[model samples]
Target: MGLLDLFIASTIPVLKVLLITALGTFLALDRVDILREDARKHVNNVVFYVFNPALVASKLAETVTYESIVKLWFMPLNILITFIIGSILGWILVQFTRPPPHIRGLIVGCCAAGNLGNMFLIMIPAVCKEKGSPFGAPDVCQSYGLAYVSFSMAIGAIYLWSYVYNIVRASAAGTTIESTRLITGQSSRESSTAELGSCTEPLLPSKEPLASEHRIDQYALPRTKQIEMEDSGNKQLLSKLLGNINWKTVFAPSTTGAIVGFMIGLIPYIRKILIGGDAPLHVIQDTASLLGDGAIPTLTLILGGNLLKGLEGSGMQKSIIVGIMVARYIALPIIGIFIVKVRLGFIPADPLYQFVLLLQFAVPPAMNMGVITQLFGAGETECSVIMLWAYALASISLTLWSTLFMFLI
Candidate 1:
């Protein structure tokens, strides 16, 4: 397809999201009050706990088979690479910009987690159905595209919860400690306490260092007993690490649904029960799919509501916003193209697959991060501000990169 045709084709889906998001903004206005604070919170709850999980589970169960997963093995690796590179960039931005401790996580998260789910789920099928689409046979293209999107959503959710969750949580904790110090009028000790309370250090056995006398006494123990003590210490360390992990955060409702969906899709008996027209439990899939269908619009509305804060932001820097735009929109897509081209031997030659992979690099940050920040009660305004600029820029960035991706792939 020609570049202009591709750009037009790519932009249609984004425009749809923008329209819905605009409605959200309008509803959130004081005059309308339809999507006011209480309403937005309730809607966010449904999306996070119910709608997202249903969407992920239904789509994944319908599309992902063992064979398909095997063929698509490189996708998970590609997503991991995005997070790794984005994180490195985020760290660099943090060091250079010197943002407050609480907002550092928001910056890293914006870089690391792209809006991999809703945007792709919307854009891919729309692109597939377009007359000028480069991917062949609309029906086949959509089926494969949905499968790619499902995988992207599931895997991205897993990484976001396990990795980015902790980053934001730590930031939240630090913010709380600093706030407590300020409230209690501990002006002089606040800096030292904030440093002490920072979550940068791993949860360790003790913060206190062993005295030289204690070290000398430990060396006086029998060699055999010392070895045994060291082994026991290692075991305890492993156990402590395991215990410290917040399993509830890691296995969010969406992640749990993904696991269930993978089980249903991969196992023959389960797939027979839940999938296909003839399945006895097909009604369940239909119901879930119906609910899942709500995810994109609801999410976009929340995105709009969140963007309302961007207009009256919490005094975020223009530099940080510019850095995120450059990293996510400019640098990441170049890296994605390079990786896909270099690894062509392993990556499927399907144009849709290649396009989705490249598009993954170009989309905005996940809207779910707003919900996460809300849940933690920290950085909500800052997160909103960052998302507003990133998504605003996404309209142009996604279109331009989509055109380039279509031509390259």
Candidate 2:
């Protein structure tokens, strides 16, 4: 199919994906407000360790035949390292501007990691199949995608876990209280010497104290926390970077799942149960396909939601929407081009590598980002706006971007 045709095909799915996702999230929120918060965290844990990583390893195993393992591993390492570099570079650039730390983390994560596995996997392979690449067969697109997705999955999980853990830890520390007064009180009292922290100052005198001998009782007075003190910017950025560094936490489920799955794929004994025969891996393959379809679109809608919410606005809030539009189109893509061309010189203009790079540049901001933000107790409304904008704007951005690259480069 022609490039224009590919654009029409790939982007249309985004709308359905976006809308259903938004609807599901709202429904989920309205039904269970408090429980949803707890559920979201556990869900993140499940996706990171089990559902998501299994999806990656299984997809790779499917694509990585005897001949393709070397490039399968090596080519993706190139993309992973390049993406890391891009993430750091973008981090430094945004840091100088001194935006909120959560916003900074949002940009860094989106720039570094992406929705390639979920969003592009379905679309790009079909496009490649239609075009009939010289690599070997049309399946090269899917194979190529395996490597790309692995790189993304590895880093995306790491980044997400890190981002989330930090915020959660901080939030817990900030809000946790050891005890609260309750009914059937045993009448224990706080030591008078110990000052109780107040969220706000003591109530102002109802009547002006005009009389001599008027007494003001000293009580726990509320003090307004300065914005600077209340600001969690640096803490947010650090949590985003450092929260999930433990090796055991990062790799336990992924490693266990991978080992079991791979053993099933490799061994004749286990293969019988999963696939019914060693000759054909039908059972495992079908199961893999089921996870594959649900994972990406679910993930895409999440991206749409986050992008919808995250963009917030300019400092003054005037022209804020305009600023957001510029950030999505003018700023990010421009930087993406500079990184590909001037910053990191393309070693070779290989079509596959080019496609991978462009795909990274184009993924909309993700819902996972908003999840991370909420977990961290960071800028919610702003994250929501920006994420939504990025998600909503991705179709136009990707279409125009691909068009420009086709003509200009």
Candidate 3:
């Protein structure tokens, strides 16, 4: 397709994709806060066990096929490789910042799961299927599907891993950091004993009692002094780079979903849900169409969240926002070209190979990054900031680059 076709068919519609997701997410966000604590817990339970599962189940049940199964087998490999590189890249970028250990988990996790599933899966196809698309909906969806299914499964794993790591890190820091000097044998009270001189014996009891002479102890400190002290107090910074993780519980749902989905794909009856319409022969196709419907919306929500997070303003210094574009579009395409032209030795660029590049190239920055940042509580200001930058970058850069890469190679 010509550049004009590219812009008309893809870019404009993609913008709409972002708008809808941002609007939906923004609306949904306060649902977490306005609800009572117990209500929030119940909502969380429903979303995770029911809503989220339905979303996943619908996709899996609709779209199982032997071919798709084979394609998915290769999906995790890309995520594993790309995540390693992306995580290291984030770590190196934040190295001088001296973030706490939890921050590390945020960076790595965010980089681990690209927005292929939660956001891009929706945008890519929707954009491609826009009224004027060069390719029809089925063709566009198929192309996008191959890339997203694998990417999403990998993301499921990334979330569980990141979640576990953060929980463990929080617990470890809570236990080991010794914030309470009373328990660790370093209380300031211990130091005051020497200064007490003759009064030491009286003040050193198991519980320090206020003598009548020191009645001021019962009075609250003055407002000005309290405010002054509070203002001057040093805040403990949280370092989230290269964080610790817990693996077992984190990957549970995704592992369950992916394995179940894949297994279902293998069995005809199980795979029928993924496709719709006729039974037996057309069942797989019908189920796939329906379940795949979620691929875009999930990816869209993620991208919109990233965008509204302030990617537009995350200039080069604060986050390598532009660098993300370069990585997803420029760097990745170059890698694809090098591999197809040199590593693979001029083999005809097949649909399978094209699918691989499309998935890799179109995927936004890792989903784990945002979660990772939240986990460590470091980079909170700019953690989502970086993710936003990467998200916006992927919107335009990923689609064009992937399609171009396929054609060029």
RMSD to the true structure for each prediction, in A, is: 6.5, 12.8, 13.8
Best by lDDT: 1
Which residue runs does candidate 1 get wrong by more than 4 Å?
Answer: 181-236
Spell out the clash pairs found in candidate 1. none
Cα deviation of 315, candidate 3, in Å? 13
State the lDDT of candidate 1 residue by residue for 144-223, as single tens digits: 88999999999998888888988899888888888887887766677768878886867685667757536554656598
Q: Name the candidate, 1 or 3, with the larger lDDT value.
A: 1
Off by over 4 Å in 2: 1-3, 6-10, 13-16, 19-46, 72-78, 81-107, 129-140, 143-245, 252-289, 301-350, 374-380, 404-409
lDDT of each: 0.89, 0.52, 0.50
Report the C-alpha displacement of residue 317, candidate 1, in angstroms.
1.1
Model 2 poorest 10 in a row by lDDT:
176-185
Identify the candidate with maximal TM-score: 1
Q: Per-residue error at 111 for model 1, in Å?
A: 0.5
State which candidate, 1 or 3, has the greater TM-score.
1
RMSD after Cα superposition, model 1? 6.5
The TM-score that candidate 1 achieves is 0.89
- What TM-score, to 2 decimals, does candidate 3 have? 0.61
Per-residue CA lDDT of model 2 for 1-409, tens digit only, reads 3566555545554555566656645634535443244455565555554566667656644543434443334444444554555466546656555554445555555445445455656545544554423224666656675655554554445544544334334433333332233421344444422344432556576777665655432232334334433466777877876754554444544444454555554565545555533535576666765664565655543443343334334342323334445544566567656665552543345455555555555565445555555655655566566556565676677767755543333
